[model samples]
Target: MLPRYFYNFSTFMSMFPHNYLIYGADVSIVGATALIIFVLTYFKKWKWLWDNWITTVDHKRIGIMYILAAFAMFFRGGTDGLLMRTQLALPNLHFLSAQHYDEIFTTHGTIMILFMAMPMLIGLINVAVPLQIGARDVAFPYLNAISFWTFFFGAMLFNISFVFGGSPDAGWTSYAPLSELQFDPGPGENYYLLGLQLAGIGTIATGVNFLVTILKMRAPGMTLMKMPQFTWATLITSIIIIFAFPVLTVALALLTIDRLAGAHFFTIAAGGMPMMWVNLFWIWGHPEVYIVILPAFGILSDVISTFSGKKIFGYTAMVVSLAAIAALSFTVWVHHFFTMGAGAAVNSFFGVSTMLIAIPTGVKIFNWLFTMYRGRIRFTTPMLWALAFIPTFVVGGMTGVMLAVAPADYQYHNSYFLVSHFHYVLIGGTVFGAFAGIYYWWPKMFGHKLNERLGRWHVGTFVLFFNMTFFPMYIVGLMGMTRRMYTYPSGLGWTALNLIETIGAFGQGASMMIMAVNIVRSIKFGERDVTGDIWDGRTLEWSTTSPAAEYNFSVLPQVTSVDEWWEEKKRGVVRPDHATFKPIHMPNNSGWPFLIGLSFFIAGFGLVFNWWLSAIVGALGIITFLFLRSFDYNTDHYIPVDEVKRVEAAAGR
Candidate 1:
């Protein structure tokens, strides 16, 4: 048994301190949990949630789960952002102690990037890619379930840090010397190392699965050139993930060894050099930036071309640019630390390589502009986000190029200027694109549209507040405001701008809340979309019913053009042949994924507490499940022809 101190009242209560802020969080978490339980009990939805979602192998349902999880993380990460801003709102404010602020920022960066943006984009991919390619499901459906569950468990492990022990405070990068066993001997960095290892495995598997899916599973007539641009982006992004993630996996594993086994992979006192860690990290990290943004680029392409009622102008050029960006992404890691004495030759080579990415990227921007030029445009919520992205992303890109100058980067390194620049791109790029995608695909995902009036309010306030929050950081950074500072003395002259930034952060938070409200309101009573093409979209995803049937299409679509669905729409009859109805082979939903996720969570939790016996039990559970799965040959079922015909007829397909 564990020691009595481990479960002492004071220790139990430490996670929820007796302060107003913590009390508020405690109330919110408890109240939300109670409300959910009450609603589920009232509606008798536990079985429904379990059968339909928890055990689901269906790609569309899994995608919805991913989005739900991502949004929850977004709120969590956003709360961390608010706390950091609150602390920095005034000079020398003691609202949050230094340790607390460090933990918040670390969690904020790690969650937003790893748990929030990644899952959101992956969710979009899951929902759209197979549908776009005219496949009934991804190539390996059981593996898909495993991927999501692993990711879910990984995120859960990372999130439980504060509750069990102290949160990771060495920043998301978890640099060496700082993160070594001596400087940080807690289970906090252990969470960072292990949580990411678990999640990164799933990510790598997803990459291979999608890569194989795109490579071999497309509809009969679709050639590479004929594939939808979003599918193309999915292919390239998956390749990046496949190529880039192993480096991270190795890096994390080595760091884990250093921390747990007392190895000398990155400890300063040992022969290990910390610079190797930075290099390996950025090798994966730079490509990761592209991994998140490229899908959004694909999203913007679909959104602009649809809303403008134009074939995406220069489709071939867009593909080339995407491929170019992917290739260039791997060569620019050194630019992340030009001031680290990598020498002029090394820095210059990386700097020039970094700027070269802008060339292909700029080509894409111009292509989007051309697609909208003189075309009939509908300024819907998704299109509004896209339109806003052009100018804002351009500014971010410009600043990025400025940062790429090796000599000049010495000045901007680790400053608020660097912070401002990235938010401009990432928030302006990935977040904007995510919101656009959410709005654009709401009908397809939920069978109804979100309120456009409220959507406009959401976008308007978000953009305004986003600029107010980060744009001034550039000014303050030039005035010598360094980052990672919890508080500063009153004479620093950073107070006014920090206050503006805090107000902006809260404004952004409020807009996000309004967005949540809009989703709920619309789901209860929004415009129903019987026709699947809610946006007159130019891809195969719009060819199916809203919320899509289990077998995405009754008959696989024969693709011939880049905008095959649009071409079909122009001819006005996309009716599938009723005579061709057949039984569909589908994977059976299994409870094992949830069980597997639970086992991994248990192992991760035990490892955090150094409870080796508990960890061993959980690990054995994992092995047992794997053994059971390997021998159990019955993994699939068939949807009868009659059921397919009935569903198709009801959907008016």
Candidate 2:
């Protein structure tokens, strides 16, 4: 008690073993202060955020949230891509260390697949599926809310790994030996396992949600045969997600037990078989690619039809091919590791399946071509991306077939060529389709059109850069350049191509920046389009209001054919008569989903620091939030029938 300040310092010092406890206390105090400030700022306004944004189970809002998360993660992953690209831009650069490169790639792949592409696809599906199917909302709105929050939480956990401790560096696949505890003595791998486990739950839930909605909630007049092609793609994608994601969950769980508790599922020293992990991972991984690209295929089908002013050609054949591809995707996982000595029979079987996929995929290409063959085509930005897909995907597919030759794979496996092969398809197939879908649907989602001039600039820059960046990797792979090396010797004749690739990376980055600017400008002052039939859209979505309402269709649409809305326009079926007035019940907003997300953030920190107390507190926070939210039984209410009638009347005008 010699001095009051000295006493305070002593107390703080006593709380920590060394200086370690100081950061913890400081964080705790800051968090406590922030909580107080949050409460004070919203003293009486808590209801506003809750009612307006949080708990409203509107599909469009949910979709926006998913897309928002995806975009945020995209930049984060892209920066990682640039880092990796720069690292390999020259021989023996040593610009970044091996450990850093490992984490960069691991985070990039994990985030790109789980956070970027998956959510982008899901967001588009959420916004478009209900409208396309003529339904008011998803079949289970509460489940939809839960799924979105769960995904948000998983992303939060993954990001938190960067701040506290480390992120997984075991590549996105997290193969064994490297993934084992003895090899990776840090929290990174654990973060990956836990984060993905959480995300897997959300992904599986989403699959179930869409499946039930598509199968059971179609409008009274709609039948399977008359379903839009996008819905068919969604159906197959969901089936694959539901079945495949669970396998991933199991694999992650096994890995977690092995890492945390020494259970020996993948450790050779513990009588475990590492190949089991490989098998389980590929079981999920192969289908996971289809899970992404299939929906893109569907988007292309619909967009090409709309812009071409024609119905999708050979619709039945397209559907059949999708089903076949989905079936075949599951059987081709072994092909990924053909060079790993899986034996001639195993390799031969997977090679055939791998090559077999091209047939259905080729059929889809022909169908798209025929759809655009005789019809008048508009060169909209979305159509531009679709057209770009033709050559880009074909190149990737050709490399894929080349790799399918098991002997050739022996030469290409783990080489830069294989890397080029996947980037071609993954980027050309999934990334291009996502961009096209955004351009196609932006009017309906945002009530304004993206700047067409800027859009063209972006497409032109990105296409040229993307090909320039990846095309040479094929040459490098053929010249015996292996992948995953942090540095390479200069005399391998890989220098010129690598430098060219780096320049391409910069071009792609600049193009992305242009897109970001375009979106921001569009939201502020871009020209708005009033034509409900933007692009003379053939799907039900175009029939709804621009920037679709929270309840979607006020009166559920009746689908009389596959291109129901298109057919309606042709027949001059301008409006469905409003029989009577009824209140539209909608989900009320609640803060608990966000509260749940915040708790996961805290729990992730706790796990990273080995703080048992913080973990307990976080768990309590999550449980309390969920429990309080469950007591909210305010799901059903009515949208006034008069209100609905008036809105429809105005829409007719």
Candidate 3:
């Protein structure tokens, strides 16, 4: 028997309007124009953006670029959120078609999770790791640039769907049956698959790079135990990405093969089990949440300790709980689909495991609290995000626990409650933490601190509006409003909350605009900051000049304790006074990383078009770039001893 609401691929295609062809043509023209502009700009004397930005492999530069890219994607994703909120504000509103709504949530989730949050975390890791450990650069500087550009190219491919054809309408998870070729034959889904796969390769590359960097690139005397909290988080996050993301790669590949090559990993009539896709996807999906949030945990820890002017509390417990969370996060993905008839035994096991994760998380919360106890807390913007996170995360965690009850999950599954729960955790934890890191490190990254008064506006309005928007989702969810539905009957009593949520969504938009204004003002006209110790920081990061140099530390510090800079300062160790300088070896810029990224973009487009020749060209581009890189052999050149001596002499060291 046919399942309910079945339709063939051709019939499904006929449902959409014919306006897409024009849209695709317009997009192609725009992309071609942009490429021409890029070429013209680089060929002119405005080559600095390409030379200093595109080809430079400095971790700080790369981190800033990652963050700027994420913010751009954030606004793009926010537009999706606003549209979803507007459409759902009133019952039976046809302002947006069901197809459009599907695309909204799909791209919203994709852009936010994969492009915005993940890249922001990568940015944080890139900027902080070398500074915290007193290293000159990441172990693989070229790989760092390659990884970031690769991800950027993938994001470009995903966004290109808007012009060339249409955005993907499958949900972000792109579940099987719904995502199979027969159901979603458009090139949009193909774009999603290829774009994410290309980006996934970059994610894996970054994971390996960070893992090796942390393991091998510490300062002269720093040990594992002495490593900062954020470094530990980066280590664990890298491990999770390395192990968990491959599952997604395999699942995505199988889906692509099923769509393009007629293989039947998920086709219902061909003895393929869609359940395998769900199982495999969630195996990667659940841990992916932790992969993004783990760094936030580290960010909160660092912020708390710095603002509180104390050592981190119960460091051993914090470390152990982090490990526990990483290990346990992988065991609980099945809870996402308890309503799918996974059997009582399986659901019960996953439910219990899911709830167990809360324990380690709770332990972490207490560690932060104790770290802030009775200490002089400055309550900076970063600290504000940290404070807000505690209660907000608890609420989200409570909802998560409520949903973890397998028997009760049947009510909450596929409901807005799940949506609200994740948004709370995601926005409250990861997004807030990312912003906090920005405020905390902006001075160090760029030679100026962000405007504090404007920052207050950004933080205050964002928190207020964010809560107002999402809190009502819980109420509507409890009243039995299901998720992903474009319209509903008026008698459901869901209009008021939805309207309130829409208004809050507008508030979020305004807050983002304010943030943009602050960023712009700070860059062009805001007060200049010359202080090395912006925020009177406690870490070795502050020991270097603000807007740290290409080689982070001229002479690697001999660390003897935690908060090494603080201890040295307390002992009256003045900069340029008892400090000796050494010659620096730094990597030169190369266009190879950019070439690799461009090739991946080409390969992604070829996969989308099923053009073998284009694919071959892309492959050759990549191989040639790699082969040429191997033979260049001029990766590192030394800062001469005389140069080092001159700098030291000038500083009076």
Q: Top TM-score: which candidate number? A: 1
Question: How do the predictions measure up, each by TM-score?
Answer: 0.97, 0.91, 0.94
Best by lDDT: 1
TM-score-superior candidate, 2 or 3: 3
Please write out the lDDT profile of model 3 over residues 278-362, one tens digit for every residue: 9998999999999999999999998889999998999888889889999998999999889789799999999999999999999
C-alpha lDDT values of all predictions: 0.89, 0.85, 0.87
**Candidate 1: stretches off by over 4 Å:** 1-27
RMSD (Cα, Å) of model 3: 4.5
Error of 2 at 242 (Å): 0.7
> For residues 1-653, could you state the per-residue lDDT of candidate 2 as single tens digits?
23643553454334332233335535765796799678857786666656765776788888888888899898889888898889988888877778778877999999999999999999999988988998888888777877888788888788656545556889999999789899986678888887887778778999999999999988879998788888999999999998899999999999888886779999898599988899999999999999999999999999999989999999999999999999998899998888778899999999988999999999999999999999999999999999998889999998899999998888899999998999999899999998999888888888888899999999999999999999999998899888888888998799999999989988899999999999999988877857666667898998888876666777678777889888988888555558844678765555676677667656654554445455677889889988887787865677787878877776663
User: Mind giving the per-residue lDDT tens digits that candidate 1 earns over 1-653?
Assistant: 45643554344345443456655666777798999999999999999999999999888988888899999999999999999999999997899988888888899999999999999999999988999899999988888888899999999899877555667899988888788888887788888887888889888888998999999999989999888888899999999999999999999988888887889888767588888898999999999999999999999999999999999999999999999999999999999989889899999999999999999999999999999999999999999999888888998999999999999999998899998999989899999998898899889899999999999999999999999999889988887898888998887778899999999999999999989999999988888989998788888999999989999989888888888899998888658788888889899998887887788878877666566666787898888898888887889989999999899989876
Candidate 1 vs candidate 2: the TM-score winner is 1
- Looking at model 1, the pairs that clash are none
